[model samples]
Target: MPKMKTKSGAKKRFKVTASGKIKSGQAGKRHGMIKRSNKFLRNARGTTVLSAADATIVKKYMPYAR
Candidate 1:
């Protein structure tokens, strides 16, 4: 079989943590900050682990990320 081609966009957007969790930047911070509360901004400042269901999808795009 041929080697699988990793998704270029996924490789740049998602990261495989040391523990194997998929980490990506928090959502809802791209715009509309005026409507977003200070607490939300603070809490969503860094990357977050993708939910198990969501991680499964990302994993497909990054076969070798495991």
Candidate 2:
């Protein structure tokens, strides 16, 4: 049998926490920030846990992360 390769993109984007939660950055901060409010930008400035359904898909890409 052969070992599976981790998804490079996923590895860079997602993080598996010690408690097994998948954390990812919030979207919408890439551009057009001038139109956005400071509160929105402040709220988006950190990682958030992925939902159960999304975590399942991410886990597939990062088999060793578990």
Candidate 3:
């Protein structure tokens, strides 16, 4: 059988953690920073774990990650 292909977009955006959780960058930082507060920008600086429901879908796209 042929190998299953991973979703390219998901592979770029999501990462599988050591404990099997999915990590991704927080949203709303891409544009309009002038209107956004400094605290909001500061808080969104790092990656965050995906919620269980969302992680399930992301896992489907990255079958080999787990």
Candidate 4:
């Protein structure tokens, strides 16, 4: 059988950590920053882990990820 291909979109948008958690960037940090509050900006600075149920689905699409 042929090797599975990584989902390019998923590869760009989500990351798999060393421990197997799905890490993603915060939304709304790319544009219109002038209207956003400092708290909002600060909160958008970190990555978030996906829930277990959702991670299951994402892992299927990213079969090559660990």
Candidate 5:
């Protein structure tokens, strides 16, 4: 049987941690920084774990991640 292919876009954007959580960069920071508040920028500075609903989708894209 053919091997399952991982989604290239998901591979670059999401990371599966050792404990099986998905780590991804903050969203909404690509443009319009001036319109955003300081607090939003501060809180979105680093990676955040995906919620259960989102992680399930990512898991399908990255079958070998776990």
Candidate 6:
């Protein structure tokens, strides 16, 4: 069987933690910060865990995660 390949885009976007959880960046952090409150921007700085169902799909693109 052929080796599974990682998706470059997915690799850059998602991260798999040591405990098997998927961590991702929050949205609305790139631009338009002038209108957004400091509190909102602060909250977006942390990583979020991907849900089980969504993680299953992402795992395919990130073969090494498993």
lDDT agreement with native, every candidate = 0.95, 0.95, 0.96, 0.89, 0.95, 0.90
**In model 2, how large is the Cα lDDT of residue 54?**
96
What is the TM-score ranking, best to worst?
5, 3, 1, 2, 6, 4
User: Could you give me the TM-score of model 4 versus the true structure?
Assistant: 0.76
For candidate 1, the TM-score is: 0.92
lDDT of 5 by residue, 6-65 (tens): 999999999998999999999989999999999999999999999999999999999888
lDDT of 4: 0.89
Whole-model lDDT, candidate 6?
A: 0.90
When 4 and 6 are scored with lDDT, the better candidate is 6
Most accurate candidate by lDDT:
3
User: Hey, what RMSD does candidate 2 come out at?
Assistant: 1.0
Residues 1-66 of candidate 2: C-alpha lDDT, one tens digit per residue: 998899999999999999999999998999999999999999999888999999999999999989
Candidate 3: misplaced stretches above 4 Å? none
- How well is each residue in 1-66 modelled by candidate 6, as lDDT tens digits? 998889999999999999888889898888899999999998889888989998889998997778
What C-alpha lDDT, on a 0 to 100 scale, does residue 55 get in candidate 5?
97
Candidate 1 residue-wise lDDT, 8-53, digit = tens:
9999999999999999999999889999999999999988999999
Estimate candidate 3's alpha-carbon lDDT, on a 0 to 1 scale: 0.96
Q: What is the TM-score of each candidate against the true structure?
A: 0.92, 0.90, 0.93, 0.76, 0.95, 0.80
- Candidate 6 at residue 11, lDDT? 96
Scored by TM-score, the top model is 5
lDDT of 4 by residue, 1-66 (tens): 998998888889899999999988888988999999999999889898988998888898899786
Q: Candidate 1: misplaced stretches above 4 Å? A: none
Model 3, residue 33: what's the lDDT? 100
The residue pairs that clash in candidate 2, if any, are: none
Structural RMSD, model 5 = 0.7
TM-score of 5: 0.95
